[model samples]
Each structure stands twice: as structure tokens, then as C-alpha cells.
Target: MAPGVNDAIRQLILNGRLNATSVMMPAAYIGADEVDALEMLNAGTTRAAIGLHVTLTAPFKPMSNGFAPLRGGAFPPINDMMRLAMTRRLDIELLTIEIATQLQAFLSAFGHMPDFVDGHQHVHLLPQVRNAFLRVVSEIAPNAWVRQCGRVRAGRALHDPKSLVLDVLSLGFKSQAARHGLTTNPAFAGAYAFTPKARFSRIFPRFLRGLPDGGLIMCHPGFVDSALQSLDPVTTLREHEFAFFNSDAFLHVLAESGVTLAQPSGEARGAA
Candidate 1:
């Protein structure tokens, strides 16, 4: 969800290669150039879907303070957060406040609510976080669709454990969002193990084949810089993805797969 994390990603949007990106608020604030780049991207005609990337875990701080779990600018590991969820120890109120704070940050930077919202590591789908996320969006940004991770389809390799785990969490998420009067992308893909030297060219076409009509496939494509390399482990792969998507090869793959990239229909997007 950290779309403005680096220039390469922003340039992809500017060049009409990527259709959607998510903002990681603190990252944008800390590196204001990223925000500036986002402004440039938004000014263009690509109509890219810009969304918020909710961060509620380690390596990043919560937008709002005074929450016991994040008191010292320290984010617990994912396992700890999951444990807290299982024990009903998460402070839903604090979670709600932090999410709202991030939403406000997006509004301040972009002059409107996000085109959509999702968690940095899919945390929006986690137990307490999911509840807080749904409630806050329903209040402040009811029109924004939340990402609903659906099952990985047959085209993906069977050994794709990361995608499978995401699928399990995604089960019934659409119903949950619908109950909150929010909409979700019917399916999701573009998750992987991030193995070294893994080729996007090989896998991307498979994902295209697997996607259903109106499905959303998440991506993290950019040119690797020192900043991105430091913040994300999956660095070079971003360049690979950027290359493929920006190339005629990508268009060929889409043609071969009998699929095309398009914005979600207006009805699914709601008011904004």
C-alpha cells in the first residue's frame, strides 16, 4: 500500500503502466518528495486507483500515539499482534483512532479520501484490526472499497504457500465488508514467496489468466533505490515487474490470456 515509497513506483503510474497504488502515510510524510510525486501522478489522465496502505506492525509506527501496544513507536511482530487478537487484548478504540489518523493523513496529502484502502501486510484482514478498519472506513470513507483477498486460482503454482495463506484469511471477508455496507474486489492475486531471482515475466501471465472479471491484482513494481532497498527486502523484483508491465511483452501476455486491464466498473466503485 506504500505507493509513494519511491520514485520508480510513481513513475510507473505516470507512464500509464500501473493502475492502482496505496499510500503509506508515514513514509509519504517522512519523504515528502514521494508525496510530491504522488501529486504529479494524480494530476495525470491514467485515473490510477490511489489507496491507503494501513501500517500497524513493526518497522513502522502507528499514525496516532498513546496506544499501549505502540507506546514507544514500537510495533510488535505479526505473531504478537495475532496473539493479542486471539486473546481479545487488542485495543479496538486505539486501533480505530490510528486508522482514522492515517485516513486523515491521506486526505491532507491528496485532498480527498483514498480511492481504496488495504493494510500494509494485509493487516486490515486481521482480527481486531479488521473490525477497527471496517468501522472506521464505514464512518469516514464509506465509498472506498477494501481489498478482499480471495482464493488463489489454478494458474498459480501449487507450491505458492504465501498466496494460499492469504486466501485462507480472505475467506468470508467480502461478506464481512458487505455487512458494513462496503464493497470489495471480487478476487485478488499477485502474491508470492519473493524468492531471490524470481521472475515476474513467468508469474504475471499466470496471474492474468487466473483473475476473474473485475478482479484486482496487487503489485509492488519500482526501480530499486537505496531507500527502497533499505525498506523492502523484495527490491530487484520490483524492477523486474516494472519492466514487464511497461513493456509490449506485457500487452502480448494480456492478449494471449484473452484479458485486459481496466478500471473497476462505476457501480463497484461507489460515489468516488
Candidate 2:
């Protein structure tokens, strides 16, 4: 996705079709045109929170130069880090350097501090990542909010096996965030495993009804242009996601469900 797609999503959110968007900053589209993102933000044309969509994946391409500790020169870059971390192969110094690099990149690209922090593919929640992530969060803004995927309300039946993994990961994440004084949404969304062509109108609203106010909803919306596809494999399916999320149905459901849209405002949890 490029400036065109991001602008479209910003419009959709302004029109109240979607709630939030998590972006990959160093991934060209957002990074290539940080000025555009900042302009939209400064104008308040988009109200969704802009968090650090930390990239540890996409190895063959590293995003920044200043941050160290991450291993580059491989495909799906962060995969190496994850593999090492899981198998006890990660170097603590490298991990620290890489995260710091990402942080510096975010500030440079966006030209201000992030409103909250979350990982691309939930990387920030990983065991090794959580430790490094917190230190950065505490240092960067100290009071800016952070995101934890934990779902607090009980008695909800989780269907997918992947959800089970998320639940376990989120549990630990929530604890770490609090220890660092990072505020998080009571719920987090935006995990669509199936193809984006799959109908999301019903699915999205059901999830919205469950959305706790003063929380966050993560969404990936982009056109499946050839350029994007070459850069990222799932660009084809995510194109549908862009259109669907920006649709009239997406907005209607939220209204019907009485969901409120809010953006975090530093050290505060909002409901509206």
C-alpha cells in the first residue's frame, strides 16, 4: 500500500467506516511519504491512533540503519530473530539495538511520538520482544499508551486455535505493560486469518459489539496493486480488505451496534 491507499483509509475512518489502522512505517508506503501521514494527522482528517507497527519480519529488507542488534541479509528479516529467540538463539544486545532503531525510525518518519505501540504480526508481544519493547516504550514517551491484546471480560468462547495462542500471549503482555505503566485498550482487533475476500461485514460488527470503549481496533486496509503485491505477498487479499472496511456496511454495523470511535490521547483512555 502507498500514499493513495493510506489516504483512502484515512478518508474511510473520517467517514466513520473503520475504527483504526496499524501501519508498517519503514515499509516504504508509510515511510516513503511520512509527510503525507503527518499532514493528515495534523489536520485531524484522520482520528485513528498511529502506533509503532514494529517490523522484525521481512528479513532481506531492513528498514533503518541506526538501530542495531537485528540480523539482516536474510528473508523475512525478523524470522531469524524469532527463531533464535524461541530456540534460545537471540543475542540480547542485538535485540535491544534493533528495537531502538525501529523507535528512531518511527520518530523520524512520523515526526513526533507514537500515540501507542503494537507490533506488526504481534511481534511486540513475543517473550524476547516484550522485554526489549517495554524498555523502549518507557524511554520513548514513558507516558504514551501501549497496546496489549488481552481480553479481560470472561465467559466468551474462543473458537479458533490461533486465538488460544493469542490469549496466552496477551495474558503475559498485559502484565508486562502494566509493570511499565503503559495503558492499553481493554480489547484489540484486526486478525483476519482467512483471505480478505471472505465476507467481513458480519464478522467485523460482531467483533465491534464486543469492543470495549476506550480500546483499539487494528485494521489492515490497502489496495492490491501490482506494486504492493510484489512487495508483500498478501497484498492481493488485503485489497478486498481495504474496500470492505471502507464500505457503507462497515459503518452501518458500527452505528447499529452502538460502538464508539476514539483515538488515544497520551496517558488517557477515551470513550466516544
Candidate 3:
């Protein structure tokens, strides 16, 4: 999550529309008061779990600068990094250091380990990055879980090819997590191609219906701002999501699908 990412999400958690969010530690938008308030609101309810959104791509600076793969002190684009990994061109030692540094940043900012961890563009599931992630978690945050992207069948209106590619990339993630004694969400949804004209109202209901019980659905719902637009290409879609989630339509769909929001297991739990 970045600066404007939290506003609508905070409302969703409080209003019972969303239950989880991942935080980007290095983003300039992090506010101590906001995070503290969120923790307070979730104290007993466990309506949401704050997770670390590990960033290993550009438009932001790396916590450590000496990493060999970094371009101008920031990570290169996702595909380029993947190419480097596939060709054995990345520095595994530097990758290890960067991963450790981000985890440490998470701890420092949150004052405790994050409830879970995942990558910005699913980089955590990549070749060398996966090894570095597992190693760091095993040493520093052995009990905290991780997010694993899983494939969803293509529905009429919701077809995100990139999400499918990511799911295929992370095919053995659950088994690998189990091998390392780390828990993970069983299923995943909420991937989109970020088309400006896409109607979330049509797409979201289908998504909820297709989702399995205890499955996890990631979402981005925020008021768009210059900062957000500058950082992300999926700007308008976020507002669309925010509006859909807060509407009565969303509630009706959840009830129709027998989907009740619950915090992922392994955290504090009570009435939300």
C-alpha cells in the first residue's frame, strides 16, 4: 500500500467490506497515527490483518543501495527482473540483503512483525527472490504467513491474463510454504487488467460467487489523487472498486453468494 491506498481501505475494514491490506513500508504516505488507529480499531475484532507488501520494483528506492540489480537505486521493472532471474544474472547475495532489509523496515515501522508478507508484483514468488524470502522469514519471522497467488477460472467479464501468468508462476507455492512450516491462504481472487472502462459492478459479483469459502480476495479501493496517478496506472479502477464495495449492491451479492467476511485464521478474532 502507498499513500492514498489506505483511505478507502480503512473505510472498508471499518464498514465491513474488506478484511486485509498489505502495507508498503518505504512509501512516503505511511502515517503513524493512521496505523495506530487501525490497530486500535482491530484490537479485538481482527477484522483485518496488516501485512507487508514487499516492493522490489521501480518508482521507489531500495532500502539498501548496493544491490547489483538495482537501477538508479531502485528496482527495475517486473519483467526485466524476471529476465535477470531466469538467466542467472541477478546477484543472489544482494537479493538476500535487500529482502532482509525490507523485512527489517517492516518490523521497525509496524513495531512488530507483519501478520503476512507478499511481493509488490508477485516478485516474492520469483526464482531467486523466493529463496531469499523463505530464508529471511525462516530466520526473522518464522510464524508469519505469506500470500500465494492462485489461478482462477476465466469468467465472462473478468479475464486478467497477467494474474493467470502469476498464478502459474506460483504453482507450487502452497506446498513450498508447507515444507517450510508457513501458513497461506488457500485460494485467491481479485486480479484485473485495469481497463479504465471496466465495470467493477459487473465483475465483482461474479468474483464473489466464484470464490471458495475461506478464500482470500485482494482489493484496491481509494480516492484517486495526483500522487496515486503518478505512481500507478490503475487509478480510475480503484475509485470504481471503492464505490462498488460501499454500495448496497455489494452487500446483496455477498449475501446471495453466502460469503461472509472473516479475518484469515491465526490472528485475533471477534465480532467485526
Top candidate by lDDT: 3
The residue-by-residue lDDT of candidate 2 on 1-272, one tens digit each, is: 46546766776766655545555655666654554654475374445656666677663245544443444453245555566556665555555667677677777767777766777667777787788888888877675666776543541347755556667888888888888877767776555567645665545654564566675556566665656656556664555666776677666766787865664344434223
Which stretches in model 1 have alpha-carbon errors above 4 Å? 1-5, 28-33, 44-46, 155-158, 264-272
Runs off by more than 4 Å, candidate 3? 152-160, 264-272
What value of lDDT does candidate 1 attain over all alpha carbons?
0.74
- Cα TM-score per model: 0.89, 0.83, 0.90
Better of 1 and 2 by TM-score: 1
Q: Rank the candidates by TM-score, best first.
A: 3, 1, 2
| Clash pairs for candidate 2 | 56-78, 58-76, 58-77, 59-76, 59-77, 60-74, 67-101, 68-97, 68-98, 69-94
* Candidate 1 clash pair list: 1-22
lDDT of each: 0.74, 0.63, 0.75
Residues 176-226, model 1: lDDT tens digits? 889999988877877876888688888776676557776777788777666
Reference-based lDDT, residue 58, model 1: 73
Residues 1-272 of candidate 3 have per-residue lDDT tens digits of 45566778888888878877788876778768767866775777767777878888877777786877667666888888889877778877788888889888878767888778888878888877787787787678877778887844543233567776767767766667778877776667777767867888887766664565566777779988888977777787898899999999999988887878875544422111
* Predicted model with the maximum TM-score: 3
